[model samples]
Target chain A: MIEAIRECLGQEMDADSRVVVIGEDVGVLGGVFRATDGLQARFGKERVVDMPLAEGVIVGSGIGLAMSGLRPVIELQFLGFGHQAFHQIGQQVARLRYRSQGRHALPLVIRSPFGGGVRTPELHSDAFEAFYTHTPGLKVVAPATAYDAKGLLAAAMESDDPVLYLEPLKGYRLTKDEVPDERYTVPLGKLRVARAGTAVTLIAWSAAVNVAERAAEELSEQGISVEVLDLRSLNPLDIDGIAESVSKTGRVAILHEAPLTGGFGGELVATIQQECFYSLEAPIIRISAPDTPYPLGGVEDLYIPDVDRVVDEVAALAKASA
Target chain B: MSESRFLPNFESIAPFSRLTESGILDSGESPMSDEAVLEALRYMTLTRVFDDKATSMQRQGRFGTFSSVRGQEASVVGAASALDPAKDWIVPQYREFPALIRHGYPIENFALYFMGNPKGGTIPANVNMLPMQISLAAQIPQATGLAWGLKMQGSDGVAITFFGDGASSEGDFHESLNLAGIVKAPVIFFLQNNGWAISTPRENQTAARSFAERAIGYGVEGVIVDGNDLLAVHEVTARAVAKARAGDGPTLIESVTYRTGAHNTADDPTRYIDQQELEKWQQKDPVERIKNYLRSRGIWNETLEQEMLDSCAAQIDEAMEIARNTPLATSDALFDHVYAEPPQRMLDQKLDWANRNGGAR
Candidate 1:
């Protein structure tokens, strides 16, 4: 996934003279994760510039650059660090184009790695999609696979509206897939049914999709076929996709790496219930992190929801209804 | 021998004033032609008239809360005079009526904003002026970025952002200055030191004697000009813009001025300011000083003053009429601009509001 991000950024910068990369250590250092590696040397310092350690200025510069007919792909270092620049991203960048009544076209992509399970420092692995998803006029995309990573990054670069592109910290190098060399784009506001099933459906995105797929495999051994739904985009959430899956399977479980209370799962659960109230056989279940700050790096494996947690919860829902 | 007579040997800055308050010009070649002086003074007077009328309209509940540019006319106008609208960009804070008008923004745009219309921000493309930002110093970074973009495009254009004494205390100001310095961004940080952030005094904003002195630590040059002196403000800004376009990096300009009115319609300055201080600023009013200067040059008289006042009154009335004739916005107007394509949740909210409002939305 990390390679996919770097290669696509290279391709996009090569393709468009307007595409410029800006962030902390993005120039010579190529970012902490090397997501923008080797572009500065090829594109020159002005196009792939290293910014001062100021998140507000980074995002704020993105807005001005976008306004001046440039497509800026800004890296925020980490999702949790984005809170420091929330006013720029949330207030101005998200609302400027809309408030200008379509006069300002802000083609800015704010890319940040999110989620836990990798032993990283505090504030480096928080899943903060809910905050961006809740903002109007901003699109949020979370990719769970390398194929989607390259495709979504390309799509975000090509998008007219500002996109909050959230990459997974755990899946950056751990998760691998055969991404095409040629540029391709996956449309936003759509979901993919990774695997089809009959009894129950498990919904997740980003790194949590791994847990859902694994849990479905475990449940299949017991003859309880579980459908897996990957919500590729959070803002224009594919409501019809979730509704169709939930109606087919009578039960569901929502999973995410963010905290339990006020997490995105709550909105998904409510949405599914509203769409398929009569199809529900038992109370829906949610597998997520505890409502607490991200724990120490050593306890990350235990902190984030795992396959065991997903399998246990779905099995309990199945037994409860039967 | 015990107490040697010592005169102040430090180079004291005689505040750069080309036009004296008593209708006299100090010995030097004038920076402006007679027509330019008249044009500047007219712009200042028209801005003052607009502000006064806006205040009255707000008092009568015809407009939303309004901030008056009562005493900071020369600071805005003179800085605006330094820029060519074709090359330089103006990123302004909220109280920039004269600058916006000088940059080709219609006066009715401000009236539209005061009347609570979002269309007020939609300035024409050729003007090269950004919309007025209400968040203290947030536009500073954007200005730097725009300047950087211009430099990247190999254009000899500069971007200038306006803020006040209070905004100098914000983190945005410091961060923007730092970035502008590091990248050698072709930008100018124009600080209108109006002595108050609502009620906070300039002395309380910083302990560093003057705001311009901080430029040393930020790796940028800075200048201090008499904000009420139009010639001084225009000259200093022109120099700064020249250096920025020449690739000498950013500049911090501290324009010392005063705010003579209440912060906004919602607050009264009498509760927080000393009456004697208000009297002192009123004496140095930028418009009166320029009018005196023009009068000293044999270009201003009773007939011109009368004609100018009458023309300004009619222009303001026309602008207000435009704002007044604009129909009130409905709840659907809120949903219309939220996104290019309304998300499902936004659509649902709009539908729900329409249902509750008897299809009014």
Candidate 2:
């Protein structure tokens, strides 16, 4: 997925002089995660900027470049590290267009690896999509597959508003699929129905999307039909898609790796209740990590909402619906 | 009119002034043209009128709270007038009522923003001013970067950022200066030393006896001026801006003045400092001094004075009417512009809210 993103950026930069990538350890060092490897050598140091150790500066500079007709894709090493730059992201980049009444549009893509699975340590694997979700002027996108990543990233880079592109850590290296090196943009407000079923619907995104997929496959073996929906975009949710799936399934198990309280699941549950109320045979269920600061990666196995937990929730929903 | 002096150094780091308190031109000075004087007076008057209108509207619950620039107009207008509006950029702190106006922010913008409308100062791209930075001195680095960008693009433009004396204590102030020096960005760091940072006086803010001297540490030219005297400010700023546009690095100008009113209407200055100092600073009021000078020159007559006051008051009244009639911000608006396409969570929240409330009421 990271390679696909790198290819997308390289292709995009090749066509436009206005596009630039900036972040800590993005130059010569490539990136700590090597997400931006080989690009520095391809595009000189000026365009592939190696920013100072100030995330706020990185976000702020991205805003400036975007405003002056430049498409700046910023790399925040980890989602947890974004707290330092939240002001620029939340206040300046996100709010610039709305606050300016469309006079200024910050076309910036902030890419950061998120979620927990592999043992990376504290502050390195937090699933903080909700923090940006709460902010008014940011589009949050979490892609599970390489195809969605390249397509959505291409879209995010070109969008008129600021985008918070969360690259889940578990999927960065582990998830690989054939991603075509072409200029294509997947619309930001669409959801991908990864698997189809009728009895129950499992909705998730990022690494949790994979968990939901595995859970659906396992549930199918148990003679229970399950639908797994990958929410490509977190902000402009595909209401029609969610409504159609939930109405067909008659039950739901919303899953995410983010902490349970006030996470994206709470919104999904309410959305399903409102839109597919008459079709629902059972209450909507949410399977998520416990409501606590995401634990260290060493203990994160206990924190991430895994395949078995998702399967169990879907099974419970299927039984209840029956 | 000899090309204004560049990086002039005096033995002391105190206030620099070419004009006296009486408005008498010192030696080596020729009287300004009638048109230039009127232009200066017009920009300053507009600033004063704008500030008065904004503060009054905020008090009346029209706009959000504002940082008042009542006594600091000279520093704002003086430096703003020094720049070529087409080729220079102005990065303002919140209290730049006059500077924004000078840089072509429509009078209606004040009403739009101060009247609690989201449209308040929705800055246009063609306009060289940035939306006022509410955080103290945060715009300094941005101005530096902007100047660097302009330099790289080979545009003959200089960027000037305005902040209060207290802002000089912030680390961002130092970092921006260092970067500008290293890159040789054509920028100016203008500080309005209003003697207090929301009740914390200059004495408590920094130990560097003079904020202007801080420029020396960063390898940029620094000058201190009597912020009350508009002429001294204009002359010094004109010189600094010229050097900057000429590819010389940035300059720092500290305008030593006092904030006569509370920091905001919420503040009570009477509780903190000496009433005597306030009264003394009031005697050196920039507007009063300029008006006195104009009256003495016979350029401002009783009729013109009365007409100007009436016109300013009438304008404020009309602005108030517009603000009063403006509708409040809506809820879907919260979901509207965060991004070009809001994520699923945001869409869901808005839809759920619409379902509960029967549409964003």
Candidate 3:
């Protein structure tokens, strides 16, 4: 996964001189997870610049650079750290295009690692994709695999809108794919069916996608057909794909590591209920962590939804329907 | 913490002046030519006239609350005139109408902005200026990033951002200064220490002796100048612009000036400022001092003043007339410009709003 990101960045920077990478420790240290490893030596210090430990400046400056007709890919280290920069991200970066009546294009790409299960310290893991999804002018996208990561990065660069690209920390090293070396772009705002089935559909994104896939495999062993859909893009969500999947199955479960109260899962459930309400055979279940701050490493396992939790809930729905 | 161990007395970049308070030419070694001085005098007078007109218009219930750039004309005109507008950019933090005007942003747009129109904030494509930033200190970091891009693009362009004394306390200010120092970004941190950030006085804004002194901690050059002294402001700004273009790194310029009016039209200065202090600043009026200097040079008189004021007043009157004639903003304008392409949800909301507004859905 790290190699995939580095290759995409290299290709994009090689292809266009306008593309530059600026973030904390991205240049000399090759980023926290080495996602940008070797980019500095490959792209030079000027193109791959390391910034001070200031998140607002990182995002705000990215806005400035983008306004100056340069593409700045600002890395926020982690999603939780993005709080320090939420003002810039939510205010100037997102609102400039609209407020200026389309006179300026803040083509700033903000990429941050999110989701829990990595035993990270305080405020290191977060899944606040909804905060960005609710924003009007910005584009929000989350990729669950290396293939998607590379493609989306390429697509984000080619486009002119500001994209808040969320990368899962667990996927950085754990998730891998036979990603093609050459550059390719997977169009944004689309969902992928990771595992197809006919009985029930499990909708998930980021790390939740893997958990849903594992749950689907486990449920299949017990003769329960479960379809797993990867909701890669959260902002411009593919509501149609979700409606079709739920109509085929009649039951659905929305999953995310974020809290249950107002996560992206809630929006997906609402959309599904609205479009596929007649096809529903049972109430749509939303599985998520309790509405509480992410616990320390000692109790993280209890907070994150696992394969068993998903299977237990899915199996019960199937049993209730039968 | 030893004051003199690491450094000597913080050399005051003494404010340069060629004219006295009453307008006598105290120093003859002026940087500007005779014609340039006349031009500067004209701009300062026009800015003051526009400021008074805006305040009066607001009080007459024709527009919203407006920030008047009264005594800071020299700082505004000087900093703007020093830059190459075609290559340089101005990140305005509001209250820079004079600078924006010098950058080719029409004064009528500013007048329209106060009249509650979004199009009033639109700077033309030829003008290198951003929209008025009401959120304090946000433009600091943005300017740093802009300079970084300019350097990367191999352009000699520099980025200058204007802010108030109240903004110096914002975290964005320190963060941006540190980043600009580290990257040696070709940016200028222009602070118009206009005595007050609304009701909060400059003395309460920071513990540092001066806003310029705060720059030293960020590892950037700190220089102070008389914001009311036009030549001093222009000389320092021109030097900083050239230094940035030469890639010597960023400089923090503290334009020591005063906001001679209420913070905004909604404000009443009597609530916070002493009448005596207000009277003291009036003596240092930017336009009158420059006019006096030009008068001592046998170049300014009542006839010259009347002609310039008449022309400027007529121009402003025409702009106000145009604004009064323009139709009110459409409700649909709210939905437009939120994104390059409006999404399905926004489109639906726009339709609903239009229908509810006038059955235009």
Q: Candidate 2 lDDT, tens digit per residue, A1-322?
A: 8898888889889988778888889989888888889999999887787776767666765665565557789999888888877777777777767766677677789999988887887788888899887877778899999999999999888888788999978898888898876789889989998998888888889988888888888889999988889999987778899999988878888888888889889988887898889999988888988989878756788888778877777787788853
lDDT scores in order: 0.86, 0.79, 0.86
Please give the distance, in angstroms, between residue A56's alpha carbon in candidate 3 and its true position after superposition: 1.2
> What stretches of model 1 exceed 4 Å from their correct place?
B1-15, B351-361
User: Interface RMSD (Å), each candidate?
Assistant: 1.8, 2.7, 1.2
Which runs of model 3 end up more than 4 angstroms from their true locations?
A: A319-322, B1-14, B359-361
B1-361 in candidate 2: lDDT tens per residue? 5775755443556598755676655675633455565667666676667667777767777666666777877777778878887878888787777677777766567667755566665676678877778766667767876776676667778888999888878766876777677667788899899999988988998877688888887788888999988778888888888888788888989999899878976788888978999988888888777777677667887787678777776866776676666666566655555556555566777888766765654
Better of 1 and 2 by lDDT: 1
Could you give candidate 3's per-residue lDDT for residues B1-361 as a string of tens digits? Answer: 6455765365545655555677665545776777877777777877778888887888789888889888898888878878888899999988888788888888888888889998786778888888889889988899999988888888999999999889989999999999999989999999999999888899898867788888888889988888888877888888999999999999999998888888998988888998888889888987777777787778878998899999888988888898888887777878777766556767777889988888773
Error of model 1, residue B164, in angstroms: 1.0
Q: Score the docking of each candidate (DockQ).
A: 0.55, 0.30, 0.73
Model 2 CA lDDT for position B157: 86
Q: Give the fraction of true interface contacts kept by model 3.
A: 0.72
Which is superior by DockQ, 1 or 3? Answer: 3
| TM-score for the A chain of candidate 2 | 0.97
Tens digit per residue, CA lDDT, model 1, A112-166: 9999887887778888899887788899999999999999999899988899999
Worst-scoring 10-residue span by lDDT in model 1 chain A: A96-105
